[model samples]
Target: MTNASDAAGDEKTKTANEKAMAGSETDTTSPASPTVRTEHEDDLDDAFKYLHDHSNAESTSIDLAALRRKIDWRIVPIMFVCYVLQFVDKVVINYAAVMGINKDLALTKNNFTNVGSAFFIAYLIAEVPTGESTSSHGANKVLTHILQDISSRNFHLESGWALTCLSGESVAQRPQEQPTITLFSPHYYTKSEQAPRFAIWYSGLGFGQIIGGLISFAFQHVTNKHFKSWQAMFVFVGIATSLVGMATFFILPDSPMKAKWLSEPEKAALLKYVSINQTGIQNKNFKMRQALEVLADPQLWLLTICTICISVSSGVITTYSATLIQSFGFTPKRTALLNMPSGLVSIAAALIVGFGVRKSESRWAWLVLCCIPGMIGGGLMSFMPASNRAGLLAGIYLVNAITGTLTVIYQWTMANVSGHTKRSVAAALIAGSFSIGNIIGPQTFQARDAPRYYPANIAVMSTQAGGAVVAIVLFGYYVWANNQKDKRQAVEEGLSSSAGNEKILWENLTDKENPNFRYVY
Candidate 1:
């Protein structure tokens, strides 16, 4: 009986090795298309290397649903906390404006608006380098979290406008942190499963809004002589943010392959399932070709423009909503409370569109649907009389619906782009465009237009409409590109549009280079 059992185990090991070897050969030069190799052997994905070495491992039965749940529980909460703290740290300045930071710091004229703009300026400059750093350094997401922790520590040091300027610099590191957060879902989930997961984490922005408001409101009651309420709020949020950052460093896995809790077989199985994305698991090679392709990729440009347009409204909401409410004859404490409802609006919109995309698979449609309410809200804010405080306040809440479009945009970029270098560059471009819009958003609100910034409100309305139009154009472009690829494949290879093999999926090819890749709208 012992001899028989050993023989059976040996046979199983032999069969597993054979299967792994066969899988590894799929990406090699094929007889049908013999002109060139899809990728150099050195450029193969990290998952490819893992599978090659683990060839003799026995195949274990895995419940994909259970595995997914396990991954979600372990990683999603960490991501959620990181996002919440980042936003709260950044927007705490908005709350502080009402808490008398401007008066206490002796900021006059456009000094307040400049402070808001300064954050995005730093954010824009840091975007590309951060993306490059993540890609070149083995795509480790934890590095950014550590950087965030270091930046958060500075929040406790400065006083006066110096405190606010340091806040801008600290939060500017967020652009570095965000792409990694958004990039995490695509690694584990398929196109269909990604929307809701993205929403789950991105909703941290809304939670930050609510929690920031409560923090500001609570701190306003502080009666200390040496430290003001705003100063205390900074210290409290800074300490909390640093703690969460430390937790992220220890808890979050850089990628599925790096996840310590998953067994070797489980990791292989997960990688195989997500291979359908036609976007390989992490590749560290920085291809100059892929980097150059970004400059000319129409999809990248369109996505960047759309992000910029929608983010204009986000800037308005993040920096000035409290100031707007206070301008409506409310006290500082009441203004903070009033801002809390907008958080609910943001959360509701994110959940609605997230589940909507998952159910209907119409990302573009959901994006346009979100923009409509935002445009309506912009109109209301622009036209409603200030005496009608309730009406204008309703407008402010409705504007938050546009925030959902950002969640869609984030998922869309990850799902549609392929190749590690191209994806990284694209993420940076989209993020930088966001900073550009934010810069523009605050500049539109000159002190000259005190109570009612008509120009800024109109800019919000116009940009929302523009974003919807561009989203439609982007959808049309994807459809046309897919058709063109199909025609070329039929003529050159005598293959149908769906004629893709596992080999093509593992190759580190860009969406343009990979004939198998189909863009997800």
Candidate 2:
């Protein structure tokens, strides 16, 4: 009887405290509690529920000034240098190819071309796992792993294995060490070996492409000719990249949450900024099950398809940019000069998309805004006669502008998706589509259609339009679904619209089980 009296008195005290606390405007919900079990446990459940839900909420405004002071510019520059060198080393091949790589290697029409396409096949296979590697381990870990893989593959080539294509062409290849050359034939290697090596080459490409932006930001002062210098451009870049990556091994943060360089206040600010920004998936470990679940989603698959179409359009340049420019009667040097503008456009696009676009909210608009010009430009170049050199160059720049649009698409994928597994899988899916387009892009460049491949230009224009339409429709659907889910959740909790939204904000109120999560289109 004494114990029961004590419990009643304690309950009354708790009620009084709750009422007093409720008068103030701070969330006190439990974060760790599950919304299951018996209704009879109302008081206990409410307390636990409040604790679990309120932990993520706070009233602190972002201190932009203090946060800027905390940034380690030294570390950022080193990271930037590492990324730049990685890109320049990979793409120097493009400039080198135009200069005379095929002639030096004695590469035939089929042989020289096959090596380029082979990279994509390898990229598609390796990139999925590599994306996961970034999530599971960290950016530094994945970058290190790639470096190791590339070094190993280069060693394999150096040790005497001739690279070949399925067409039975012994493309320009490094010679093997064996006295008898019979083993050097296409019969010597397995398809499995070729696939992985090809994948690695393309994986290198993916790194270069993404890091290109980081490079541009780091050294925007350097002229194109300076960057294109024979010794400094390729050889210096390779050496510098290796050195900077070593430096970054100590400085670069693995994950935002794991950044020890930040003080407690800085860390809290960072988390708050990311949370309100709607930057998804800050956790370290990769979740394979969640990735599989996302794969099973039709919305994700459709996005992949859209990615493939857009990639194919962008990929035309990967295969035929120099050749097409040469066909226009520009000298080799002039063609190289023209290519620089595209990179500039890409850099501009990254800045605008990364900064100007506040949320993943209007991805479709950004995509179309960039894409429509690309198609119009490509169409003008392809359909218009080559006699108009200035027109053709203008069209080429337009096509190049698509690079920025493609980057935005990639960013959108990262923003919309949550959980490491889904992100890895989704990244791979998008990359694989990119590879397919690369393979297909070059094929569109028929020798007969050369000097002016009207059909290839038409194809690019049409597909880009298709991609835009799909993005628009999908984005609308995503917004509509979010609204319906919000309503349902509000009704379930017996809350008014504003109150429900506040509750949801405090509790992570979106249904993880319900299939209504909007895929950023």
lDDT (Cα atoms) of all candidates against the true structure: 0.79, 0.48
TM-score top scorer: 1
Q: For candidate 2, lDDT tens digit of each residue in 282-324?
A: 2344445676676576556667767777776666766566667
List ranges where model 1 is wrong by over 4 Å. Answer: 1-39, 138-161, 494-500
Weakest ten-residue segment in model 1 by summed lDDT: 1-10
The digit string of per-residue lDDT tens for model 1 on 253-306 reads: 778888899988778777766776777778878888998999999998999999
Query: What residue runs in model 2 are displaced by over 4 Å at the alpha carbon?
Result: 1-62, 68-83, 147-234, 277-288, 359-361, 494-521
Worst 10 residues of 2 by lDDT: 171-180
| Native-structure RMSD, model 1 | 7.2
Write down the TM-score of every candidate: 0.91, 0.69
Q: In model 2, how many backbone clashes occur?
A: 16
